[model samples]
Target: MNIFEFIRDPSQIGPWFHQLLLSAGMQEWVANLIGDVIGVLLIVGAVLTSAIFLIWLERKIAARLQDRVGPNRAGPYGLLQTLADIVKLLTKEDVTPDGADRVSFNLAPALMVMQIIMVAAIIPISAGLIGANLSVGLLYFIAMSGIASIGALMAGWASNNKYALLGGFRVVAQLLSYEIPLAFSLLAAVIWTGTMATNNLAMQQGELLFGFIPGWNILVMPFAALIFFIATLAEGERAPFDLLEAESEIVAGPNIEYSGLKFAWFYLQFFVNSLLLACIFTTVFLGGWQGPFVDQFPLLGIVYFFVKSLLVLLALMWVRATYPRLRIDQMMTFCWKVLVPVTLVVVLIVAIGARITPDRSINAVIISGANIVALLVTLGIIGRSLRRDVQRRKAALPGRSTAQV
Candidate 1:
């Protein structure tokens, strides 16, 4: 069967979706394999395509913001930059470290890509666009995505590089720290949405927050959304939180020893990981494919979802360009000291507000207001502390003596 037939039928019988194909007796195995293979291709294709577009979009947005011309030479608006890069990468020689563990080193990138593609299969783009709407959809995503760290560690260890090993260690440490806030945010959603299922969470967004506004989780628990976004960026190893791959400090981090298509796989995984990040953000906070306009138009849901995801992706890229990465100490401190406390409070407030207020509007107002107050207070404290430190430093310095010299 072709792509269209495979997608339309949904009776394919691979291990991924075989349980659903129990009724198809004769062709079950063949059909399922076809289905699974197709599913994998579609997901991988989507990742690569998204990566290409995202690269172009990031450049365009950053260029506009920085008052410079971005990619416009390669194809129209330089849309094929990623594709070109892919071709170049593909033609390059694959290199393996002489001391590297060949088996694990080769397996690592494939494992990384596989894990990402597996998770992508679960994110339903449209009503019938899901691979399998498993009951434990959100749980599946968290659990499956967590496996990437193992791949990272394997890549680090297999390569026999100190920096790669350190990068892997840092990634694991960072992910562990940030995952708490991420889980807490998801928990807040589960409380508000009342279901762990992806579809249910999407449906919740259709419910009105007050009376007219669509009831996105963001409106209900804005703080959780903020925390989740930041934590996810850290989890995804994006900038400001990307101490794992800090180029200045650690060359190329975990994938430094990888070359050619193996390296390409790592890059591809990052892009796909970005897409997954966007989807999770949409599902958890922005309401998945559910939206006021999309409810009527149906097809508009895809547009809405993609647009929101793209905007978010661009924001991350912008952050990557604008912000210098934090020191490892600062990265850890920020997660443990700042994000953990904030998200814990957000979760607590969400629980209390959910108990007291029947109306989502009032609860949203209360929760969002509380979050804003906390943010402002934190900022004020940080500002004062920094000012005091600066003044003390100036006082201690040999100011006049140094100036004369």
Candidate 2:
């Protein structure tokens, strides 16, 4: 059967197989348990498979972006490079520092990875494929996203190395600084829907404006979306915000003392977190699974969901490939001076808009207009401030652009 049919009648496939197992003399409980196992295996398989593809894809994109060949020798188009690396890591020596805290050092990678894997529990792959349908799905996600930093700290402090300790401390400062704006941005959606349910948020965004445009959250709360996306860059610790792992400065950051498979987990976690953020961005702003014909052909929702998510992922890879890393102070200043204020204003707008119109569509339209005005106003203020700063700096300079003696 085609996807649409499978989606339209999901029970048909499951129940038919179940009955066949019963007819073949399997116990009902055994059959049910086997089915559940298969479902879980599929989910795990999908995550691992996607993670592998993303690793290869990121490298290929990085290579193309820089006009260089990357990983061509490992496999065709370098597709098998990640697997080869995994095998290599698996076989490498796991050297733990003598002074390291044995327990925390060992547990750190698993702690970091557990939170990322838990993220998949709430994400719906298709119309009816969520692992869990919690009412506080958004809250759950936000909470899960934050815990990974603790693992970094654990790794850093446990390493008993000064560099590792510094990296861990930086992780706290950076994550804490950016998470405020990120939380506020997400709160805009929560305020708009009056619920933290991921599925509900997606449904809310599925409406069309003027019968053509998809009423995604980005349209209604554009600033929130922008702030959230930028914060994802920080959260993922990608370029321009990757202070925690500045190789030249800190020498591989918190995972400095980790080696072999332990180091591999830390390395692979980067792509996994990227995928998670991309998925979250797709869900919150881009209208997860909400596209033309997806409503009728529900199976296509899964396809649309993935396509939008991958596009977000590609944008991230592009940023990672091109943008230069920011100074730690500059990064902190941007978060505090720019993103926090902007997202606060966006969240306030969302709240006021909700108060003005209990009507979802009307409130959305009003908020959309307000967002443009807010964005313009914000940019103008920041521009003038920056211009003044430049003038001040020029006045303080010992020489002009020619740098005369």
Candidate 3:
């Protein structure tokens, strides 16, 4: 029994999928071990490559928005800037702050970086490209994000700095607040597609919506896409919601005391985390690489996935450039008061529509109309509140006398 025979004869490899290979030519354990090692290396390489590219792209985008050049000297147009930075950091000495807990501080960055890499492995980059196409892909992504928060808390606690502690608390709050609407929007997609695996959800949606157009989740559930994007931005701790790493306030936040490669680990985690959010956005809302021409030519699926994810990532950068940071109170209010109720209503409406229609597509006109109405009503209430505040401020000001006094 050779490797070929092992693959051909399924029964011989029942409990041990490679046992037949042992019987034929190669030892079963060796073959399995080799495969596992190869798989892990591939996953690590992919994750590292993505993290490097994303970091460079983010810096470039941020700089361009601010009318400054970013990292243009390290490599061609700073293409290899992140790599150069990594080398510089790696060569530097690791310095643990005297107040920091040595063990936990050393371990925190590894924990955060590892979990993100693990999550990255589960996302499908293209057809037949997934490391693990689990039934609970969406659930796994959420759970993995929760794990990253633990690392954040650990980093904050181990650093033994007040700023780090405060950053940790903020991150915990931020993650908890945004995770709700994020889950809700993804839940709508799950219900619509009838699968939790990202790849399957996208494929199921690739069919005709009303006998002609190939359906994307975005078209059927645009609001979900919008909510998911907002929540993901918050989750990624990007602008307007990036209180965790507010430089002027926290001075690098949880990794404040870190130096050398340890600091690099934290930086790497940030980029990796951004990529994870983009990947999830691609998975849940943008059809996970499924597109018009891609299905016809399977190779295009990979290109489609990267292109779509990059577009989403660039949009995130755009928001970071355009929007000011939300005050903590405003951030909280936006998540709970505005996003929560609206997403809840959206979910309910989607569920009802699904039950009633069964086979027909959801009425875009009805859904869009409802979204507009909700937006207008919320704006109207907010406008009224602002007007009353303005009036009160004006009334509180004293009238000027006849003279300059």
TM-score on alpha carbons, each prediction: 0.86, 0.91, 0.88
Residue lDDT tens for model 2, 208-269: 77666788888888878988999999999999899999999998799998889999888767
Task: Please list all clashing residue pairs in model 2, or write none if there are none.
Answer: none
The digit string of per-residue lDDT tens for model 1 on 26-98 reads 3776766767677778777877677677667777878877788888788877887778888899899988999
Backbone clashes in model 3? 2
Number of the top lDDT candidate: 2
Shift in Å, residue 58, candidate 3: 1.2
Which is the winner by TM-score between candidate 1 and candidate 3? 3
List residue ranges in candidate 2 displaced over 4 A.
Answer: 1-4, 7-40, 402-405
- Over 117-140, each residue of candidate 3 has an lDDT whose tens digit, in order, gives 888867776665676778898998
How would you order the candidates by lDDT, starting with the best?
2, 3, 1
Whole-model Cα lDDT of every candidate shown, in order: 0.78, 0.85, 0.79
**What is the Cα-based lDDT of residue 375 in candidate 3?**
58
Instruction: For candidate 3, list the clashing residue pairs, or say none.
Output: 1-24, 2-24
Which has the greatest TM-score?
Answer: 2
Residues forming the 10-long window of minimal summed lDDT in candidate 2: 396-405
